[model samples]
Each structure stands twice: as C-alpha cells, then as structure tokens.
Target: SNSALDEIVHRIITAGLTDAKGETYIPSIVRVGVNAHHSISSVSMDSLVALRVESSDRAKGKRRLEKDRARIAILDESSIVASTLAFSGCSMFSRMTRTFDVVVVDEAAQAVEPSTMVPLCHGCQQLFLVGDPIQLPATVLSDRAKDHGYDHSLFKRFQTAGYPVSVLNVQYRMHPAIRSFPSREFYDEGLEDGPNVVADTERPWHKHACYGPFAWLDVRGKEFTPEGSGSKANRDEAEAALALVKDLMVRFTELREPGLMAVISPYKEQVRLVKSLFRDKLGAEIAQGIDVNTIDGFQGREKLVAIFSGVRADDKKGIGFVRDERRMNVGLTRGRSTMIVLGSARVLRKAGPWRRLVRDAKARRALFPFTRPFDKSIARLTSDTYKVEDEVYSEEGEDEEWEDDEDDEQDVDYGAESEPEGDWIPRAEPGMSDDYSDSGRA
Candidate 1:
C-alpha cells in the first residue's frame, strides 16, 4: 500500500512527463513523498498505497540519493524543469533560500496545516492545492496531536477562510444514478455527468433487463469472523459480490473496453478476503484488473462499477469504521455507472449517515433485499471456470500468503488516474500547459 504512491510518482515521471516528441522533457522532476519502499514486488498501477522518494542511504544508493537531494536545492526559474518532493524534502533545504514559480500539493486535505505552508513560503506566484475536504482528512492518530490541531488540514482551513475556490461540477466517473446521492448529500448537488456520457436506466448490456445503476444485496445473516485476523469476513457477501462480477462480465461481454470494477471494503482484512475470493472464483486476470481495497483506496479514483462490502455485521459493534460519514462519501462516490453494495442493512441503519443513505436508496427502489441465496444459475458460464469454495476462511498459513509487504502504516497515498483530456492532464510544474481540471478525488 505504501508503494502505491511511489509507483504513481514513478509513472507520472516516466509516462506523464513526456514532451511532444514522446521523450522525457522535464529538465528535472523530484519526488519527495515519504513512503516505506521505493519498489513494489507485485505492484499494480491502480494500487491505493503511496510511494515516497527516500533520501536515506540505507534506503537507496548513494548516487541516486544525492541526485534527489540536489533536485530540491535547484532553484533555476529559467530552466523548464520540475521537482517533486515531500514537505519534509523541502525542509531538508531550509537553510538555503530556495523559491519557485508555483507549488502544487496533490492531496492537500491530507497534509496538515504547517507542512502544507512550507512549500507556499517559497516565492511562488500561483498556488494550487487540490483535494476534497469532504473525503478523507489528514491522518492524525494521537489525541495530543488532535488537541494541537494536527488533524486540521490547510485546505479546509483555507476554504473556511473565504479563499477563492472553484468546485468541479462535472464528474466523468460513476453512472448518474450512483453519483446522484453523494452529489446531493455532500456537494450541494454540484456534480453532473459529462456531455458524452449516457447512463442507461435499463440493462443495455444484458439481454434480460435487471435493476440497474444502484443495487443493494443485504447479507444480514451470512457473515462470520475468521480465526486469527480478529476481523469479520462475510462469505455470503463475498460470494454475492463475485457472482455480481460474473454477471457483469457475461452481460457486457461484447463491450470494447475492459469491464472496470472494484470491490471495496473498510478493512484491509476484508480487502484480502474479497481479493482471495475474486481470484479463487474468477481467476488471475480478472482479479488483477478488478481493484479490491479499502474505502481510502478508491479516493481520487473512479470506476465503471463499485461493489462495496461492509464487513462489519455485529449489531453491538455498530458497523465499525463505516460509521464515519467522510469514509462513506468516498465509498459511495467511486463508481461512474453502477454501485452494488453488500452489507447488513439492519446494522448499517444504526448509523446516521448510512441510515440517510439507506432511506434514500429505499425511496429510489435501488435497494435489493438479499432474501434468496446467491443464484448459481447466474454464474453458469463461470461455473466451469472455477469451483466456489463453501468455506469462508482461508486455510492455516493461507491467510498470510496473500498479505503484502507494504509495511504497517496508517496513512498511505492512494493516487487516482485522470481521464485522458484529449491528451494528458497538465502537471503543476512550470513550462507545462496551464489547462487542468479537478479530477474528482472523492
């Protein structure tokens, strides 16, 4: 997960920073984000984890490390080069008076007030801090830190200070149906679909029309706790989500583009379980293409379909992390066309935000009760491909098998892809095209 951000910086530097001749044009680009590792063994370009430029010799080679440090110190305003570094990376050169034309902070809401101000102190003419305050906030764990206002981000503070702010109204991701609720609830009905986008109400992709755009499969009675993870895993929910994936694949078999989908959970353990289920039921190719991650993972990204698995079912525990409204906003707004949510409605209704969402869903008839078990016939095509396991939990030692080596960290970068704007989204660096738009991080 930590390497996810690193991987994005790598891609942006490698793929996005090219000139008209299709060559690396930037005189220099530096990445200062702090992540656990530089490279990921089984990294996906769509991963939610973050990447950082390591300056420590123990982390990277001496030659490369020195090069990175030098990139931050370079203050050539005349040269058409870009430097990417973390706030701390800039702090390393505090003794030297360095300045630039502009400084763009990608996830401004995730940066605390002080750190965000460091880059602004440089004599920059224009400042662009892009982030959605309604989504995830800066990760502040300690109570002492909260008391000191470490949880308050500079973006939110700036917005509250009556700074000139522009909200992007048109979103290119989720189907209008799925986007409607979050747009109404969080954005004051500011989000709209792109002009070229046509969201079908009925099943244009399926021969037999089915309920669309939004679907809720209630798995109230079918969740259980796994042995060692100390987290709940719902076999019924997992099976149902996989079955939905199968149905989508078969229904949209003729589509030109790959069926983009995601299975999102609020917990890493549930993420692992869903990923395992996807692989075991579907296969490797399908699993790789479909992102399985936490709500934070889908931040700043959108997909054609999003299947949310609310893993917590215990009435007493009160739905755990899903109770947070900000997280719900991120989870609900990730899909561009369809959002199929699997959870215990009875349990979710206990939370105020989810209750309002459930109420809205019921009023719209987007809610579908999980009265019957998963339809085996719905997956007849995939039945021959792989056998569905009856057991919920993975075997001993198998749980650890799927665990990645992202290291234990609370906050990691989850970079989202910007839709190709006839070519590429403009970078924050100088000497680049000034045209750019909000990519809708939430």
Candidate 2:
C-alpha cells in the first residue's frame, strides 16, 4: 500500500523537512536568484510553490508551444533527470546495456510473471518484491492457463517454493472491533492494532450503544435489478444506505471530511444508485466528502469509516459477485475504525464467507435491523446546533457529561434478533503465520 509513502509525503509537505529521521535538509537560500537555476537533486518548499503556480496557470500548456524545439532539446540534454519509470519503460531500459544497484517492486503479487522479470533483468544486485498473495491474484483470461496456475503471481510462486518471506503483523489501519473478524477469519488473529489506534482514535459510532465501530444492517427486503448486459443493482439496499448516510452526516458533523466516508459494493450499478441518492439528499458540498463506488474501487485506500452495501438479496439464486472471498476480505479491512454493512442477511447466509461475517456481527452484539429506530437520534441532531462533545464549561455552570437515554439503549435488541441456524459457514484457508523472520538474503 502507498499508505507508508503517503504519511511521509504528508510530513514533508507540512514541515518542509526532507529527512525521515530527526535530521532536516535546510537550504542556504530561501528564494531562487533571477539568473541562477534551481537545484534538481532535492525538491524544496520553493519548488513546490512554483509547481503549484505553474499547474494552475491556464497558459502553461500554451507556453510550451512558444519555446523553440532546439532549446527544449538543449535543456533536456543538459541534465540527467531521475524519474519513476513504468513497466513499459523498464522493458525498454532492459534492452539497453545499463546496470542498476537495486530494484524494488511494490505490490508484486498483482504483477504477472513476465512483467516482474523485465525489471529483474536490469542487472540489479538486489531486488525487493513486496505484497501479499492472499489479497489478489494475477488476472488470467484463459481458463486452461489459469487451471495450470498462470493466475498465480511471481510472488506467490516464490512463496510456494519455500523462499524467505516476511509478514507484517501490526496493522495500524482498522480498529480492534473492525479488525477482529478479518484477523481471525483471514489472518488467524495475527493482526494487532497499534496503541494509538485503540486509545487516541475516537470512534463517533460509540455513541450508539448497540452499534460499535463494527456493525451490520439487515436489508433482506432489497431486490437486485439487471444493469447493462452483466451488472446488477438493488434499490432497497441503496435507499437504506442513503438514509444511514444522511443520519451520519447530520449527526456526526465533526467526523465528516472530504472522502472520509465511503459507500462500497460489489456491483457497479448499486454504487451508482447510492452515489445518486447521496448527492440528491445531502447536496453537493456534503456529498463531495463521501465516496460511493464498488469494492475494487476502494482497494489500497482506507478511511475512518466505511459502509458496505451488499445488494444481493435473492433467495432462489445465491450471492453473485459477493461469492469472491478476496473482495470481502479487502472490503472488511478498509475501515480504519468503523464499518457498517447493509445487506440481506437471509441472502448472504447462503454464501460461505458472507454467512461467517453475518454470524460474527450478531455474536458481537453489532447487528441492527434495517428499519431500526433512527428518528430519535437524527431528531436530536436537527434540534441541537451543538454536538455533545462540543459542550464546554461556562461561567454559569460546568459542562454536563454526555449520556444516552434509556430509549436509546433499548433501541438495539441484541438478544431478540434470531441467529441464522443450520447455515453452513465456510472456513477461510489459513494464510501465512504472523511470525516473521528475516533471511538477510534476497
């Protein structure tokens, strides 16, 4: 994931610091001289500012036309610039007789065998291939080829051959409640949440007694509709999800950030429905902060909160795209703290993995009915301008402690909900253990 790099970039831009350690790169000059050119090696704060101004200028593209072709050639030939080369560029470079010190490939599990070889053939002394095979396999069009294991990525092949591999056990992404199911079901309870994620992080969903950071909403009434020639959509689930979005937006105003909350589903048609409903009810400004898309659209991205709209509610026919356990694995792990699932429990219980999740949510007291009482909570937000946490001490009286009324506690009936019995829940294949060892040899 780019999460590690993203955090580093965030720190650099905010602090104008270069080194990841305590050391900082301080330039002697704050502003570039009129005649003197800028350094190309390290990017400074001034370079970022220049880039921003250049990018915003409407005439920036036109200015390229004014420069002479020979002048451009001269500028290009003057410096040896380093840049990120794509897979095509790596193949082209491999044709030449150049040698590299080290080559690092991130997300190597998604790359095909031949594509991974292109970069390895660059005469690099050391190569680092990083990714998890359990997340996604390589795409193979031919069924025969896939049957022979063409779909297995180079990383998976290496792992299967008894090659040394390291597993990152500490996950700083999801909260313990959200991470619990995936960790036990997928990683054998190997994943551990960082201390800060459990302590410092505030989950606004905790205000709801029944629903913690992880919960499921029952939408067994929804019906799937055929979209285009292949996809499907569910109007009932989409509407319920939209209502939950409205409740969260108006009630948790402080937790709202642009793209902080996302609505993800397996079907593209359902994604569109939720997006349209979200835009219609919440308006553009509030809707802009929420992302509505399919499960594949959300990989490699994490948020403070997420809602999964499993639109498949058919009884005769089983869960269509939801049958892919990998998609469910990726979706369950995306939420940093809170995750709400709205789907047909009856329909999902037919599937192996979905049934397991449905059962886990119920056992943890995180299950809620589709038409559960939300009016009382939403009404409180509509009438009160200030949030419960926003209350501060005043000269007239001290700040009152925020407490939930008896009705709010009674809203979620954990014991009343019947468990889906006699349903076969599939056991996920155990992945590599959390215990990691360094080979010191690549």
Candidate 3:
C-alpha cells in the first residue's frame, strides 16, 4: 500500500495530473504529520507539496491549513488526502469540514487502539485497517499498561473477536525457499509465493549453497551486556555477520548499493555494536549502504539480503525476546532473496519455533558453522570459482559437516521471568536526537 502511495505521489510531482478533458496540470497536495519528536513533519511528500506540520504551535498550523483550504478541496475532489493518524484528529483537519468516502490505515496492527481511532473519527463510508496481528504489536513499555490491554491494537482486537478479515495470502516479497518455513510454521501453509517472486527473486549469489535463499550460520558465541547498557551483544556474531556482508558486496558489484542489505538483531545493543563495527571496518561512506536495525524496527520493510544476529547464546538465560515467535517471523520474512540467520544452535534449539528453523535449515543443506578464521570461511563461499559441492569446508578449508544430534535433547521451558539482561531502549547515534524514531512507522 505504501508503494502504491509512493507511486501516486511520484507521478503527481514528476508528470503532473491529467483530467478527463485531456488537460494536464500540477496539483497542490499537503502532508500533515509529525514523527515521534515532531522533528519530521512531512513523512514522504515532495517539496512541491504544501506541508502543514503538527507541532507545539498548533494555531500557526491551523492558520496555514485554513489558507490552503481551496487547494485541499481540489485535492479532495481529484486525488487522495494523506495525513498521519495523530494529525488527522488534530483541530486543523476538523475545522476543514471535509469527509472521506473511504479511509485506509496501513500497518494498523502496530498502532494502539486509541491511535487507530484518530483517523476514523472523521466521517468515512468505508474503512480499511491493513495489518497482520501475527507480527509485532504496539510497543507499550509499561507492564501495568500492558496488563490493562494498552498494547492491544484495534486490528488485533477485531481479528480476535471474529470480525471478518480479508487475508492477503499471496506474498511477493520473499523467495519461495525463504518463505516455505514461515508459511508452514506460522501461516498454516496458507501463504503462496507470487509468480513474479518465484521467477525474479533469485540472486546472483544464490548459486553458492551458503548464499542460497535461506541459511543459518551457527555462531556459538558468548553474549555479554555492556556496563550501563540495557541490552546484550555478541562480538563473534557481529563479526561473522559483517564478514558475510563484506563478502557479498565484494563478490557481487550489483549488491553494493544502499538499502539493498539489512542487519537485524533482537537486541538494541547488538544493533549498535554491529553498526559501530560496520563503520569501523567498512568505513563511514560504504557502511552507510547497509541498514542495521532491531527486529521490531525492520517490520513492514524488505531488502535484497537480510542478516539476522541472534545475540542470545546463554543456555541458562534462554533466548530472551528472540524467543518471541512473532518477532522471529518478521526477521525471517524480511529478506527478499537471501535470509541468513546467525545464532547459537545450542541456545536457539531450546525454543520450539527456533529449533524447527535450525532443523529446517539443516534439512535444506543450508546450515554452516561460523568457525574461527571466519573471514576465510566467508571467502571460500564467495570465491568466483567456488562450487556448492566443494565438500563443505570450515576453518582452514578442512572438511566439516554440521551435526544435529543434540536436537533430540529435552527442551527447556523458559518462563516469562527469563527476560532480557537489560531494559530495551530506543537506538541513538551521536549528534542525533534521542527521541528520533527509525522504525519507519507513523
């Protein structure tokens, strides 16, 4: 839906609009919304469009909206009016005396009930709430608030209450190999790969077994929490992930573009560590090409390649939020052509879904060990003449095969008490506002 909106906005900005009488003219569009800190008022509108930014100075914005009413009325008649949920309920829009024939909320399941209610307050004959309740819910921090159902989204409430839901079963985002496990494990095998995805989702790297559509690198690394930090990170895992990313970019020139690859972790600290490592090892300009984010931050987004760093390797502490099935689903489904998961099999195998994921990877011949001298292991796989049937080399190019004998061991039932080692915090970089939201959601 966002893609469709982006295309519409691009057309209006570049080629203007054509009316029924073969006349074309530029149209006036206004985007009214603010990000978490009110720093970014316009979400994605072009500079040509008027912006009514919501901020502390509400009267000024209201006056600006009033002056733009004629243009707004023209947009209402010929095009769509776009506004954030919070801004839609602001007094500026209420004073416009405009109602819509239809209203559609994208990613509605990520918004709390009250937030979803904002845009609906405006009169609309038809309403569409587009979201998946099975993914991450609203990010409510207070346990007391959650107990009172503050985190439950209106979309989830409706789905749980047996309201009619239209399932968009056809997914065009992931390669079939990458989509198989999640579809069977989470969606009851109801999800189908689009024809286009099946034909076009294969990448040049897929020729190597290690870089196929789906794979899991067993990183038996130790996880540690930094002093005064409320999250966990695994240096070994971060290095291994970085190595894989570098190998891919070096071997394939087409994959060296920004936003083509992403690194996702369940822990904020892991994300921070990976980003720091990327900048230090790959340099600032080149590192900027790859996105590093937390699992919840990467929802509703996709890339050509995704590297997942599961920072929990402690058998006693269990897997932390990495055990959340919904979060795992989001991480696994984000890569369009390649999904490589880096984790400790000994730790991940304790959870049900994760154990199945590792087992599935092994069954598909996509499991590999992140041995010492990790760079060489990566190089072996990315070599121009490397063949998939090269006997599966490990450290020093020694022959090795991944074993899963421990998969049958008794499973541990970790309770909710086994929470993460540190409290979750919003990611912040130097010279950036602490409240800056990078989740790419309104």
Candidate 4:
C-alpha cells in the first residue's frame, strides 16, 4: 500500500492527473514533498529527516522544536505533501501553520478510525479513503476493545452507511487462473483480469503441469501444537512445500533468485518450522533467499510464486484461522504467476469458502492428491534428479572442487509420520497427465 501511495505521488509529480480516457493535463509547476518514518524513508521520492522532538533540557528542546518547524515550513511550501499516518500527527507537524486542501488516506481499510482522523484534522476540505474492505481490517489486540468495535475502519464505516463507492474492476497482479476463484467467490464475479495477465502472457514455469498458474496439492497432514505454544505446525505440509520449492528451483533457473518465491502459513509456529526445514534441507544460503512469513504478515505483498501451507488439519478444531474469509482472500490472491496451496482437503472442506475453493480446484482439474513421499513422488512427476549443481574452483593455480551437502547421494525421507486413509485421497481427473511438460492450463 505504501508503494501504491508512492506511485500516486509520483504520477502527480510527473504527469499530474489524467481522465479515464488517455487525456492528461499538465498543471503548473508545483513542489511536492513526502515525510515518512526513517526506516521507510528510502522510498522512490526524496527522503527527509524524521523530526525528533524529545529532549531533556528546556533550551535544547526549544531549539530543536524551532529547527523542526523550519523543516516543516519547507514542506508547507509544497502544494502537495504526503506523509505516513503517524508522522502526519507528529509534534512537528502540529506546530506547522499550514492546512491542506485535500487529504488522501491509502490502505484506509487497515487503519483504525482514530488513526485515520489524525490526517483529516489538518483542516482538509475534501478527503479520499482508498482501500478494499474485503481484504483485511485494522488489528485490535484486546478482546474487549474488539468487542467495542475498535477494529472497525472508517472505510468500512462509510461503505456500511451506503456511500457510493467506486470499484476498480480490473486487476493486473494475478494471472487469470489465479484470480478466477477469488474474483467469483469474493467479488460476486465482478473482478476481471487485465490484458497483460491473460493466458497468453504465461510464465516459463507454466509449461510444467504441477507448476501451473493455480493448483492445490491435497496434503493430508496432521497438525500439532507444541507445549506452551498457541500456534500449530504440520511437518507433512512443510516437507511437501519444500519439495515443491526444490522442484521449481531445479526445473526453472530463474526461481533461484531471492524474493521471487514465498512460503506462507497461518501460524507462527509453522512459519518457524518451515524456515528451519528449508535451512536444513536446502542449506542456509539458499533458504535465506526465499521469503517465509505468516499469512497475516504477507498481506498486500505479491510474489512470482506462493506456497501456502494450511496448518489446520484436525476435524475437531474446525480449521482455526483458515476459516476467516478475509485472511483467506489475502492468502489466495498473493501470487502473480503461480499459487500452490498445500492442505488437508477433508478438513478445509468443512468451511464454506474453503469448500468452494476445493470444489473449484477439482472442477478446474488443478487439484492433485499428494499421497506419497515428496522426494520420490516429485522425482517421478518431474523426472528430474533433486540435486543442485556443484560449483568448481581453481584456487592457488590448482584445480579444486566445491561440494554441497544438498548434492550428496544420501537419500533423506521427507514424508509424513502417519498416512491418511485411501478414501480421503481423491483420484486425479480423467485425462490429467503426470508429465510435467504437459500444459495444465486451469
């Protein structure tokens, strides 16, 4: 969302505003400034020093305040000023004597109403709130505070009051296959794919059936919670996920790059376990290249490929946080090229949206039952050895070789501790090919 805000600012500075058609009006030259936290100040725009207002001495504090005011005065000269929500309400901004003509809050659906009010209080005549209420809401830690509706956002409030909200119907991030189910289930089939992300714009990995635009590997993994821990982890799902990643890396050379792929889970314990397993099996350097995070933390982020591990498998537990449709929407829509979900279909089918998801995958012929050990099964599917190429070195004018443990001949068993019943595993649809070369267009 910060990127979206930054893009908006950049467009305003470069091309001013444009109409729906291709017409653009170049406005008179105007200065624009952005104020943000020091950590995120390295944005596309020029960075400014974050004002520090704390001081122990009265004289020093007065001088600091005066200097900060001078800095704020520089921003006041700009017709357009952008700042983070917290920075907009800082002491230095409060001391400024200028008011804005318009205030735009990006990601308003994820900000609490009180926090959203901070920028509006700067005497802006018109306001615009930009966000999707269907994705995720503001997070409230206290149960009591949540009961008092502290998590309700101003964007949702306006929508609830029957405001005329304009919907942006075309999405450019996800492939058409990856966007289909979420569009139909969440947006009442109103969302459409942009021209750039259609089936013709397929990535190289799309040639492999298993690495198609969308697929769900039915991992009948059992979930377990550790002692003194509230989060859950599934060893089977993690192994399957790792095996998928390994296969992708070996098959496609581009996937080896960092930040191109991500492995997300709903539980912190599962994220920790997946990271550890990746380090152990893939080695620390390769593992460090992948992004592993919780589903909540991965919101508003996209990757070339995404592997989601649904860690809740017990029927009695009834799918835990996976049942939250908002979180599900965010998790399902994060992949730009490919989206692979590993979970127990039996348990996920108990929830309404998940049931529809599973049914949709089956109907699209993208659902595969993962019943065998990942190493052997993936090897059979891809017909490729699960080994990384070794590096050669010539040190001190002598020919030498560098060997990696991952390239060793030792066979490691990365399977579930217990197998599920045969009835729980669904057979692949008729005419489905096990060959990776087959295009599995969903």
Candidate 5:
C-alpha cells in the first residue's frame, strides 16, 4: 500500500504522465514515519524513552541509597545524558529534530496528550493525522485531563483537533475476509463502495498454502510451565526456536549470511536469548536481526527467513507474545520470502482483547492473487520452473533424453516430506530464468 498509494497520488497529480506517450504510474512517496501519535518534529525518541521511565515514577518517593557501591566494570562509556524532553547540560531539544520530505501522523486519535507531541512538534507543520476516533483515543490525555489543566471532552477534541484533516473513507488495507470486523469495531462512517474490495470464497483452504517455507510452531504445550523457579522451562521455547534455526542451517547448506534467518518476539528477553544462542553457536551474529520488537524494530527492514520464536499463549501469564494485534500483524508480514511462526497461536490468546475475527484460511484467500502451487519442475533455491519443454532435454552435446524416470524410481514425488532442494522430486530441473539462479539467496 505504501508504494502503490504513492504511485496513485503521483498519477493523480501528474495525470500519470512519464517520458512515454501513454500515462504510467511512478511511486515517489518518500516517507519517514517518526513513531508516535504525536507530531514528529515536536517529539524525540529520548523523550519517549524518558516518558516510559516517568510513567513508572511515584508521586512521593526517592531511591534508597546503598552505602556500598556496586562493582563497576566499565565496558562502554557510562553517562547520564539529558533526555529529549528535559534539556540538560549535555543535550539540547532543538538539536534532535528529525526532518522528512513528507511527514504523516498515523492513529492520531491515540495521541490525545499534547505533552507527548510537545517535544516532537517543536517545528512540525506538514503533518497528517490518521485513524478512526470511534475506536479509542490517546490514553494519557483521555485519563486525568483535568489534572493536566484541560477540560475539553474527547468528542470536542476530535471535532476540533488537527489542521486540514481528511478522511480515508475508502478502506483498502484489510482483506475482504475480515473487513466486517473493522467495520464494526472501527469504521464509523463505513466504507465507500468499490470493486477493489471483493470476496472470493471459492478458494479452498488447502489451495491457499501460506508463503513458504512457512512453518507454525506450537508452544501451547508450555503454557502452564512454571516460571521463575530457577529451571529453564520458560526459556525452553526460546531454546527450541534456536534449535529450529540450527536445523535450518544443517538442512540448507547454501544458507548465506542474509539467509541464516531471524527471530522476532514481542519480548526483549526472548530476543536476548536468540542473541545469546547465536553467540554460543556462531560468533557475534551481525545478520541475526531477529529481536526487532513491537517498539522500533522492523519498519524499514525485512528478512528472507524469519523464525518468530516468542509466541506467548497466556495473556494473564505476563510473558505471552502477542501484546497487540497490529504488532502481531507487523511480525507476520515481515517475511519477504518465508515466514516461520515459531510459536503457538493458542498461547497468545491469553492476552486480553484477543479477537481473531478472520480465520487465517479465509484471510489468506482474500489477500493473495494466485493460489497456485510452486511449479514442481523447478530446481535450485531459485523459484523457477521447467515448462516441460518437449518432455526431454538434449542441451549441449548430451543425447536427447525423455524426462521419464528410470525403471526403478519412476514415481514422481513432490510431497511435503521431500526437501525442496533435492532432485528426487516428480519433475526434472529446469533452466534458470534470468531473474532466478542456482542460489536461493533471492
């Protein structure tokens, strides 16, 4: 949607003109989404980090000082710099401003507290506030607004907030399978009529296989495992996910630096587990970009092989993975080639407000265009296929030969049990397409 939306906007303004005679679309939407419901220029990342610390502060409290100084082993430079919101001797608020060609605020309703934007919108003018107010507003301002010296109701704030606001009446992001949920939960004005939003219920569940080599790990078995008992049962899931990653290494010999895989968990400690595992096995992994979290992790990056290890099942249990629906979706869609969900969906339901309105089967059918299987007659990590050209191959000096298997191994097998790289498949290997090659790095 990001690229396509930009392309459409460009086309709309320029009449879709290019160097060619006919109209064509070009995506020129350069965007930088500085994380927050608040204004980008008004806020700073350090301010947000400090806000997190301030949120845990007590109205009347001070730290009890221990007489004995703890052992200080200086690894990196240790210092307390001025926070973005607080101007200290080491820092200035104006120096930390981030600039972008195009700036837009997503989910503006959630940014009710103007204080969050006070440090960000110091110079922001070009801004776009986007979201549905029917759902929810910012928690900070919504709660204890009188104490913050504000008396405006949320409805009034919604009516008068922002400058030059526009509504995205046309819904486009959701798959048709689950649009109804958002319609009920979010869309107050509802969707504008359009053919782009269509349904295809005819596709069978098995017909729409997931993006390969996708695998869903079940950690539901460890839902009731006792934690903080000094045992590693809680840590077992992280360890198992690491084991799967190692299995991938042994299974795929051609796994290059970029192909080693990543582990994504909503939890930071689980991410630490992945880093430690990589350190214990391979050296300090530079490419193991798995710990990209719900907070500032994988917006501008992707991995070819993603192993999502931390799937939290128990909502009340505290260590469960899925903390937010949007965060889970971000993790789910991060895979460029393959997305391996290495945890149980059952376990994450324990987190309250877990509403899976659309079953995965239905959602996939509505999203993907082609539900066809990968061509069997392909070879290598390259996703190419032989067209069954003449049912024979006589290239080079070799004699013409039919693809019919030998008298013994005549049965073609392309089952799930078979390794995709192996030549024991039902079809013979094909010539590589220009875009594809012997290596599966792409």
Candidate 6:
C-alpha cells in the first residue's frame, strides 16, 4: 500500500506536511515492479490474495473492510487514507464512514479487474485509480486482448459510468532518450521522434568537439532462468559486472568527476553484489558514501558520466521483470552521456520489443558518435572467482560501515579518464555489436 494514499498519510503524520523533501505527499499508488527491491518478496501478489480471500473470504458481508488488514498500514491516527486494489462500483468501499477520510487505488492497472474491487466501491464517496495503461494493460495477456486491446479498466470504467475524470500527463520519469519511444507509443504523437542531441549545447552538442562524458556498448549476457522466484542473478554475470564496476572507477579517475557518475541496472541483486564488491576492493575510490541505486533510484538524477551495468542476455529478454514495456524505457534513459551495457547480442535479440528500442537507440547514437563516450574502454573479466555472498542490505545504523575517513568524495576522481583527449577510441558498439544494428541510448 505504498500507494500515493499511503505515502500521504505516512508523510503527513511523520513529516507534518503533504510534501516531504519535495516529494509530493498527495495520495497516490506505488509499485516498483521488480529490481529495486532487494528481495523478490517485496511486492505482493494480491491477485493470489484475492483468491485466498474468495476461498476463505473472511470479514464476510462485514460491510466495512476499513478494518481489514489486506491493505497496508500508513498512519496510526484516527482518520487515514490507503490504496486499495478494489475498484469502481465495488460495494465495500461505498459506506459512509468515520473509518476513512479518503481512499485511493495504486497500481490502478492491476486494480482494473472490476470483480476483485466489487466490495470496496460500496462505501466510498471519493475514489481514484492512478496508473499508466500504456505501461501494461489490465487484461489477460492473450493474443486476442493484444489484438483488440483497450484502456478501459475500472478507472476507465468509472468514466464510462459518467463520472468526471482527470488525467495527469506530465512525465517526470524518463530521460529524453528512453522516454521518446514509450511517449510515442502511449503519449503525444508529436513526441514521436526520439533524443535531443543538440538542444542544450552550443550550435552543436552533437559534434561539438566530442565531450567525453559518454560510453555506449551493444551488450550481451548468457540466458538462464534462476531456480526460484528468490534466486539471485547469475554469479558469473555478477563477477563480470564487478569488472565493469572497476572499469568505471578507471573512467571516473580519467574524468576526475567522481561525484558525477552513477551505475544503474535493472536488477537489485546486481546492484547489491556490485556495490559490495566495489566497496570492498576499491572503497577509497568510490565517489562518496552513496550506495548504488538501480535505474528507478537514479531516475530524477542525471550524471555527467554514467556507467550502466548491463546484466541481461544480448538477444533481447532484456533484464528483470519486463511484463511491462515502461521499465525498458526507464532503464535506457538513466544516462545523459555514456551508457555501457555489457550483455550479448543474443539476449537483446531475444527481447522482441526491447530489440526494436535497442536497434533504434544504437542507430541514433551511431548517426552522432560523440553523444555518449565509449572510448578507451577496457574490461578485465574473470569468472567463478569469489563466491558472492547472499545479497545484503546495509542497515540504517551501519551506513557508516562503508565510509572511508581518510577519503573525501572529491579525492576519488580519476583525472584523464573524464576528458576527451586520449588515443583510446570509444566503441559505439562494445559487446553485442553483432545484434545492435547500432541503436543506442542518446
């Protein structure tokens, strides 16, 4: 229930404001599909819970589910707000209440199943469903639905029932490169053609002396589904990812902008493993005390130099949970300059929709070579070396455990690696060159 509803109550109660540190405290829904969560168990399969509820279906005819534990807790106070998977015309939510002041539904796409929401619609006067249908529609994934798809989930159904509705169109999510395709696919038609190579630079940022803050590689990785839902990413891949991390350290030293680089991936396990190994081996060289965050974490932030960790197979299946196309868009957009994905062309080829985007991105990057730097790129890889430990989450109290007292963030900069002056040429197509067709992030 980290839905917008829950965030509002949590922030208003804890921070005493509707906004905290600039994050909107307004009621909304939240679902980090996967990867950001260190544990696969982080997200709930409430669809399964709905089945459980139906089989046992306790609180039978109980009228008010406000007391139900299905929704997560946000505030300890009298009046509270929560996100419900329940949807339009669901009777359980219609009751006039001393129970809640307002209710919102997060993951509105998932909540689109009207049958599951039948109970909540009964008691609530104010209801809202906030989700992007373009990301993933709420319907059976049949070719039939794919052929005749429509956006009319419960929220859309409410509009069909004659309720006045609102649409929030500002996309505060992706970088211009990654956002372009999804926007064209789901948003403004005018937003169709992708990437802004010269918008911010003088007369031509595209070729303006080729600023070195760039790295683009057509990546590839092996394909093998892990044993269980909770299984970790391939350890061999993790070790290779560490080598890439070390390479980034070298790049950061060249750029001398240690504080300006970031490492993004689609997998949380990759993030944990890379961060732990990088810290243990080169703790003194990291930008600062900041731990690695995945693409979702780096969203609103841009880096002068970016080191993207590619842990997916090259053919296509991209990485992590890609049931929704929106995630692929998010991953590609993490870097402003320099994005290096280290997977095989085979994996990218395997990802049908993703292949199109990768092809497009590589083509766009090739049309203009200097956009992101990949020159002087070198990788030293060795596998089956150290057995990566079970992923660990640093506790709040132990945040300082990784800190280096003698090291300041600025001291870690690798001078020459940051600039454009070396004989070392950057590769537009690094690993998965065979499949890239030269499409890359702008």
- Tens digits of lDDT, candidate 5, 171-273: 4333333344334433542655345534311122212233243434344434332354211123556666555555455545534333235566555445545
Which is the winner by lDDT between candidate 2 and candidate 6? 2
What's the ranking of the predictions by lDDT, best on top? 3, 4, 1, 2, 6, 5
Residue by residue across 279-394, what tens digits does model 3's lDDT show? Answer: 89998877776878777666766778888999888766756567778889998998889999999877787777887887777668788777768988876766678655544523
TM-score of 4: 0.71
**TM-score per model over all chains:** 0.66, 0.67, 0.75, 0.71, 0.41, 0.44
lDDT by candidate, in order shown? 0.58, 0.56, 0.69, 0.67, 0.35, 0.39
Of the candidates numbered 1 and 4, which has the greater lDDT value? Answer: 4
Residue-level lDDT tens digits of model 2 in 1-442: 2222232233322343333454443222111111111222133223533443444455855645433332223222321112122322432343343355556665678666776676555566887787767675565566798888887878899999999899988887777888898888888888887878786445666666333588787765656556343566788777777777677666678555565677778776677677777778787677756767566545555666788887777666656557667778877876776788878776676666676786777667566555534454335433435243432222231121112121211111121112111111111222322222221211
Best by lDDT: 3
Q: Which is the winner by lDDT between candidate 4 and candidate 6?
A: 4
Regions of candidate 6 where Cα sits further than 4 Å from its true position: 1-101, 112-123, 136-153, 156-165, 185-216, 224-310, 314-327, 333-342, 366-442
**Model 4 scores what on Cα lDDT?**
0.67
The TM-score measured for candidate 2 stands at 0.67
lDDT of 5: 0.35
Error of 2 at 265 (Å): 0.9
Count clashing residue pairs per candidate.
17, 1, 0, 0, 15, 68
> Model 2: which residue pairs collide?
259-289
- What overall lDDT, based on C-alpha atoms, would model 6 receive against the true structure? 0.39
By TM-score, highest first, what's the ranking? 3, 4, 2, 1, 6, 5
**Per-model root-mean-square deviation over C-alphas:** 11.1, 15.2, 9.9, 16.3, 20.2, 19.0
Off by over 4 Å in 5: 1-112, 119-125, 130-215, 220-233, 247-255, 258-261, 286-305, 310-327, 349-442
